[model samples]
Target chain A: MPKAELLDPQGQAVQSAMGRLGFSGVVSVRQGKRFEIEVEGQITEERRIELEHLAETLLANPVIENHTLTIE
Target chain B: MPKAELLDPQGQAVQSAMGRLGFSGVVSVRQGKRFEIEVEGQITEERRIELEHLAETLLANPVIENHTLTIE
Candidate 1:
């Protein structure tokens, strides 16, 4: 997800359009990215930690985005 | 999320990078968008349906992407 402090232009655009379309129930919106990855084997504790590291370093930009990794 | 039959170049790139970084456990990857929307009231069944409509019409490109709306 994007940093809370940062402005999300795409989200803003969606919110504005919602208002125009009479969807007044929506108060705010923030957009983010999701990745669904398929792994070869079970997600062991060690592998989970490794994937988290990859999510932090490669998948998400720590400077602007905060990410959470879920293995299911 | 992108359609199952469609090619996800971004996911492919990430998968390739994972291989280069020696994270061989990962077999495949799919990329998608997540929108965290704040609504004014509780997500009643009617509101849920409305939001789903918005998600389908505005947030996601039905031609290429599939979407799921979750209200928490």
Candidate 2:
């Protein structure tokens, strides 16, 4: 399995919302998108790298967001 | 720090898109939202639970999505 998350650079809206809701302890919030993927076969090292590239090129917009990949 | 992810139960659109993109090895893709929160102080056990409830009630739609919390 490959999990990819595309994170926002700034998340002021959510942070302020939490503050208004009385959860003032929340200092910051960065919103993002997560994609859980199931692949057909064993995920080799090369395949993992390929998936990271795909996450950057297709699943996430590199200009406004950053992505991280985890294999499990 | 607290991280929450709201996950979609069904993920057909992304799966199909990956298939069309020549990534036939990808069997499934479930899209979701990820929130990274920075808190003002130490996250105690009670605070962690409170955050989980907040994630379920405010951050994610219980009818269509499920949420998971991670403390880091």
Instruction: Give stretches of model 2 more than 4 Å off.
Output: A1-10, B1-10
* Candidate 2 Cα RMSD after full superposition onto the native fold (Å): 5.6
Instruction: Please give, for residues A1-72, the per-residue lDDT of candidate 2 as tens digits.
Output: 112243334467777777777777877687777888889889999888878878888888787677889999
Q: List the global CA lDDT of all models.
A: 0.91, 0.74
Question: Any idea what lDDT model 1 has?
Answer: 0.91
TM-score of chain B of 2: 0.76
Please write out the lDDT profile of model 1 over residues A1-68, one tens digit for every residue: 99999999999999999899888977789999999999987899999988999999989999999999
Q: Candidate 2 at residue A56, lDDT?
A: 85
- Best-matching candidate per DockQ: 1
lDDT of 2 by residue, B1-72 (tens): 112243334466777766777777876678877887889889999889878878987888787677789999
TM for candidate 1 is 0.96
Give a tens-digit lDDT track for model 1, residues B2-69: 99999999999999999999799777899999999999868889878888898899999999998887
Can you list the residue pairs that collide in candidate 1? none
